[model samples]
Target: MPRIGVTGHVRLAEGTAELVYAELVATLTAHGDGALHGVTCLADGADQLFARAVAALGGTYEVILPATDYRTVVGDRKTFDDLLGKAVHVDYAPFATSEPAAYFAASELLLRRVDHLVAVWDGQPSDVVSSTANVVRTARDHGLPVTVIWPAGARRA
Candidate 1:
């Protein structure tokens, strides 16, 4: 099983989550070949969706938290707790707060550990240091295989 990681927008449109989740399952299924294992931060939107898809395939995943207080900042507290609880292993960045720097550190740690990256991005540019675009770019810069998934009608809210 490939150790897949994810980077994507944290705010998806109303129906975009479902579309993205379906595509993620397909992509992950193909890459996993049979058994599936993923690594994620369990943030809102794409991260949560990816975790759900992993579970649906009876796959296990590890959670890399940006900070110790990550749950306080995530959009969906319930979902975040649910996914975190399901994680086979959990690691935290060397930070006390969930700031951009902490997120960047977490993402970098995730990149170093995963064999491939799955980005649920819209191919946009962002100046934010911890944005999904930067993560995708960083993955590419490191010569990691990346699969960008943006289904039709997918939007960020």
Candidate 2:
């Protein structure tokens, strides 16, 4: 069982989610060989897509909240709550609000718990401290294997 983790953009273009999810399933199945496990922050786009794919594959996943008020800032309330309920375990960062520092803290914690990282980025750098690219960089710095998934038709909104 591979403990894979995910980090990526939140605003995906229309119909991009399906493409990313398919790629995720393929990657996860190839890596886990059936028994799959994932770690995610459960944000709107990439994180939610990864969780759904994991469930579709009959895998388990854990959720990491960037802050106590993360849910308040997330885009899709219903989807976020549903995914949160399905998580095998949930962890929270020390911060009380959803900010860059809290997100960075959560990402660091998420990195420590997984053996591999999957980044669904568009290969762009961001000014935000805890951007997907930064997380990918951090994972690489720690010598963790990362698989970047950007399908042909995938685009960020």
Candidate 3:
């Protein structure tokens, strides 16, 4: 069983969700269907999409919250709750508050726990601390295999 983790932008342009989902399904399927596990933060855009794909393909979903009060920070409470409810395991970072540190901590935990990483990035550098590019670099530094997914017309908000 391979554990796949995801990191990507929270905002995506119109009509890109389907592309992201389809790419994820293809990527996960390539890994073979025997007990796949997906780890994600369940964030609005790419993270939530990846979780849905994992569930659709009979994989277990694991959620890692950046802080204890992650529900408040997540953009869509309904979607967050929906994914959280379906998660096989849920863990929170040691941080007490939701901040950049907490997000980085959660990212580190996600990268550390998974065997591979799936990054839904637009190939742009980010000024934010816990950007998808940063996570991909970290994963590569750790020797974890990475799959970057950016559809032809995909754009970030």
Top-lDDT structure, candidate number: 2
Candidates 1 and 2 compared: the better one by lDDT is 2
The parts of candidate 3 lying over 4 Å away from their true place are none
lDDT of 1 by residue, 1-157 (tens): 7899999999998999989999999998888667989999888989989999999998999999999998899877887888888999999999999999999999999999999999999999998999999999999999999999999999999
Candidate 1: residue pairs that collide: none
- lDDT (0-100) at residue 112 of candidate 2? 99
TM-score of every candidate relative to the true structure: 0.98, 0.97, 0.95
lDDT of 2 by residue, 13-95 (tens): 99999899999889888887789999999988999999999999999999999999999999889999999999999999899
Runs of candidate 2 with Cα error greater than 4 angstroms are none
Candidate 3 matches the true fold with a TM-score of 0.95
Per-residue C-alpha lDDT of model 3 across residues 1-157, encoded as one tens digit per residue: 9999999988998888988889989988998656799999787899999999999999998999999888988888987898899999999999888888788889999998899999998888876778888888888998999999998888776
**C-alpha lDDT values of all predictions:** 0.93, 0.94, 0.89
Query: What C-alpha lDDT does candidate 2 achieve relative to the native structure?
Result: 0.94
Clashing pairs in 2: none
lDDT, candidate 3, at 79: 79
